[model samples]
Target: MTEPPSLKKEPIGRLISYIHRTQQKRLSRSLSEYGIGGGGQYSFLKGILMTPGTTQDQLTCNLKFDKATTARSVKQLEAAGYIERTTDPEDRRSHRLYPTPKALKFQPVLQAILDEGNAKLTRDLTDEEEDQLIALLQKLNLEE
Candidate 1:
């Protein structure tokens, strides 16, 4: 692909944003059949699957998403039969999330899609380049 003239000196943040938008578009198309949303909804599902009794607040904090986004994702996942939420025994006001049978069965498929998406992102880079890029990106993740 040829770069646009205006992007030659684009800031690192802008470049990262471009990559994120492009990847999200591709991922959304790939995930359309599963009804998993594009805006980090899969992250929420994966998080719940990994930690079966996690709360919305925990997901919000860990995933760096706002409370409303987490709540919406949770609701969507629940509606799609991918997850369930029960009131926490210790705290009635809080709900604990768990993946449903459907989600559990879909776990491997979900992971394969995610893996393919990531692989596509780095397909143009050599192995060493990929490693270096990952390390550099990690460095930019100052808050996490």
Candidate 2:
């Protein structure tokens, strides 16, 4: 009997790439509608929302972003009126990041956009299939 082709030679990587490309395009368009660029903006907002008054170093470690990247993103978000940086009282050298009321106001809209995108991506999947896929993904993040 002939052996089947190796999994490494299969089209899994291409399929994954296509999925990521399509999602990126969709998210890019959706975010553009809100006048926001993708990437650091989203994470910055999420970080501030999750932990108000978090220091820049804390964001760097929590988001796994380099110090310069975190600093730049925070600055951009602050300039965009999405966040504010206040001096940390305990530490004169550090600044704590906080989301502005303007940023909080868009939380529901952002959530709706994300939900819609998720729905579109999972349109053909059953509840059980979705659960299984989520479990598989969680399994991949063992360190989490």
In terms of lDDT, which candidate is strongest?
Answer: 1
Candidates' C-alpha lDDT: 0.93, 0.81
| For model 2, the run of ten residues with the poorest summed lDDT | 135-144
Where does model 1 exceed 4 Å of error? 1-7
Candidate 2, superposed: residue stretches over 4 Å from native: 1-18, 141-144
The RMSD of every model to the true structure, in order and in angstroms, is 3.9, 3.8
Superposed Cα deviation of residue 114, candidate 2 (Å): 1.4
lDDT of 1 by residue, 14-42 (tens): 89999999988988888779989877889
